[model samples]
Target: MFSAPQHAVAVACLTSVIAVAPVPMRSAFAQSQFTDVSSNWAQPFIDTLAQKNIISGFPDGSFRPDQPVTRAQFAAIVRQAFKSPATRLSRPFKDVSYAYWASPAIDYAYTTGFLSGYTNGSFQPDQEIPKVQALVAIASGLKIQPVGSVDSTLLRFYDAAQIPNYAKPGVAAATQRNIPVNYPNAATLNPNQQATRADIAAYIYQALVSQGRLAPIGSNFPASQYIVQGGSLPATPSEAGTGTLAVGTELPVQLEGAEPGANLVMTVGENVETTFVVAEDVVNTRQQVVIPEGSKIVGRFQPFEVNKTLGTQFTASKLMIGNTPYTVNASSVPIAARKKSSLSIADLTGSITTLAASAALDSAISGNVRFGSLVPGIIQTGQTIGKQVIGKSDTSDEVILVEPDLMGLKLNADFEFLPGSTTAFVDPNSANLYQVDSGTKVDLAAQTDNARYVMVPGETVPVELKTGRSIYNRQNEVLVPEGSLIRGQIVPMTVNGKEGAQFVANEIVIGTQTYPITAASAGISPSSLQSLSPADFQGNVIASPEASQSLRGVSSTGEQQSGGLLGLGSLIGGSGSGKKVILFNPTSVQMEFRAPLSLNNFNN
Candidate 1:
């Protein structure tokens, strides 16, 4: 492990040849100078040392550039250069063969704490010096400590993982100190294998110069121009440091904010950057995200909540069915709340691109659905009861569903908001309006409180209203037509008076169309209905004709009252539908109201 640095020390000892050779043969010295070395790629330190005759090639005339250095040889060279007193030898290892030439060198290195033998007592002097181990020894020998923290986060070398674990800490210390040129490609740091003679020479020479004991090594060299002045490792690399993947890749908006995810940002160039989220990890290799070099990408997400225990439901207050509008009132309309159900995202917005709703919701909800009710509305059956009353009832006073304010559901998605897609509703929370097909309707009856109302761009709550009264069946029993009851989120309501009283749901929000609940066929359970007086049913339970027959067995005298069901058609008046009405009121009207008027007067 320590032989490579010892070889460097040996090369340093060879420095004596520089002074003696120049005097003996100027021709030989010039021939051996830095310019004479044909390895044009050699760094400045190697060039300087070659000129000094401190390191040389074999008689075969080929400098085995990849060969490993040995301990005894290195020890001899270091002794020559430093001229330090030798320490007393102690036979620490059992395997030191009687004729082993490195015994003395190994003894010196061990005594000085520059190297240590294996625990088994063998000094494998012939072993190649691993890159990391070599770096540690060099730092130890030179007593160098680079500035800044040893941030593995800054390393982007291709061979980062190849660095031996034992040498990492020392190498990191050396890197910060700027003593060793550990990486040549900026992309690779081959920690193990062999330490070439040229590499060893370069390291030793630089250490000498950094210590102010030797002159600067590479002064007048062509390659010197490419050296980044005052170059330092980055605090955060543009890519994922060390690993195979080139990081800082961006993804599309597959989910809304209510998702669980992480965003990673890296610096590509000075101020040039990109971002990615952990959500992209699922399809990373195949689905590579490509973005412009300088553009910033964001991860949009949508997440879902899964309950391991039991299923649940929630009721949302505001619901949009296509273009129609609907409201969930505790007094009038009721909604189902669900606990756990698979979620699929049909759309997404406000991100770099688009992502799948399932992907988004996975992390968006994760372990906690406390905030899940923000986007979906679902409720349990038999959860609400509609009260039956007689006279016109006021629904103004009642507390409906209670929910927490959620920021948004987060997902692993790529989504970008189209310009002007966000709009504000009566509630100040701005909602992202979705242009979906009008015919589609989704039944979300198994979501939790966190999913009741979704916090879209403009919508603040997690629970959004669904079309019609959200009916919930607790025992798996089908409540045919009349049996399908509408229970208010707050007070219970039922049909009253001769003809069943007209019940209007707060909203009928389908996929993209939203209409008011006005059809006479729509009825509420006397217990589930809100605001209606019990007497309003007049013995007639509002139900489909088929349901009426099935209820004959359970019919009460109140529901069988005959004449009590007449003249009830006018209760809701004519076409109690969703009417868009605009009014202009003036204290004084000087002219009659006219349609399609063309004003001829010009502005004064």
Candidate 2:
């Protein structure tokens, strides 16, 4: 059996080694002087081990706490802390040579049953050990055993999915022995992350403490709570009672009335009826079911004010839980529907002229406050007129009618109530319970390329989801599924006299229902660089066509035209007339979710 050196002798040997070792080989300070470990979670452990001379900082006076520990370094430390009787019949690893600096330590570690070579008979001493491997090695050396089911004990960790099958037993034993010290959130056991120097120090110190070789420190570090003698196993909340579901529990419901190709108009006070179903189950901290899956939610659209300067707002009102009609003070959060107008050179010049002329007329008409304010109103009216004449033809009038399917969308619960409870207190902060955040990319394909079809603002265009994706939280639970329907609208805008299309995602449709979502991405195909020719800007406009077929639109007059809006004129120069041009080529679209969505609102 491996044995640690007696405390007094170990301290003496460490002191003597420090005295005899060259200055460059010793730590810059006699105590904890590691610059890098000062604020580290494992600083205490590192300091204790450093003072004992079992571990040392770098020559630069810095302890790289997060740096991965190599097998050789670990072996050296193990040899310093522990000692075992050598067996006469012991054999050295084929790869470990006598001349190697770590040869002695490796031999000692192997003979002490603390380490072993690979099946191929090579020690690979320089290899960086994984956290799991390090823990397993320490557990095996100390002969620790699990007190309960290994799998059950591991489930206590938030990142249990990262634990490897082979390391389960060793990890369970380590946890039971209270030898594993996790930093930051003790609930998160990052088993797959590389074992760092700080991690090793903590593991070793805990191991020594468990073996009655060292006294425990009284630090409130998160890892301290897991020490066996210091504390008992963490208490898990009982799963017996029914937990309360917070009042602002959001149900991801799909819209049943809104369908593709439905003619819709933007008008204040418009009422659109929609039916929805809960997407996921709502469970509280006690793991008790609160809102069961498949609960139906009914809602209707209310007045949405459209402000030319600020943006448009859509609100849902009269929300009710199906037949049961649970009291809910739920209202659809006002979604920002901003419109971008495509401005051509003529439109910009005209608007400027109208405003200038209106200002001059207003100045001549009156110089007082009442008339002064009238100048702005007149300018605004002129600008509106200018847009009516110049912006209409240049920009598409298409708009996407939003009818969200919330069948599979995920939402967080904020109110507290029992399962099957009829009344739920609504929280005002829950207004944004269903907003799918930005940076979420969903694969979308437009029915027709901008080259073949003109998408006007406010016009609904058909888009098919091409790929499926899942959204997860830090706990790795699937909150949203792949291939869910996404609703988007073409936002037209002019930049530097150039017209462009910006697609803004509005909602996600799942299982015949819709939920409000906000996502955006550059409309370029993800694989466009690899699949298209560098010289051809419109290669991704259509399906793979022959080179000759793509070139058919290029005329001898250098006028290259596609079925879309601006064609090649925008690329090379708009017919040399100095007029702004727009390109209407169909482009690939991807959406990425921006917020952390809770899966408890949806059912599996």
Instruction: Identify the candidate with maximal TM-score.
Output: 2
lDDT of 1 by residue, 3-74 (tens): 233233234321321121111112211233333345444445554554454555554444554566765445
Model 1 weakest lDDT span, ten residues long: 587-596
My TM-score estimates for the predictions, one after another, are 0.31, 0.34
Sequence-dependent TM-score of model 2? 0.34
- For candidate 2, which ten residues in a row score worst on lDDT? 385-394
Please, what is the whole-model Cα lDDT of each candidate in the order they appear? 0.31, 0.46
Q: Which stretches of candidate 2 lie over 4 Å from their true place?
A: 1-31, 84-89, 221-604
What lDDT tens digits, residue by residue, belong to model 2 across residues 435-497?
333234555544433322233222223233323455554556544655555554443432222
At residue 141, give the lDDT of candidate 1.
48
Prediction-by-prediction clash tally? 148, 57
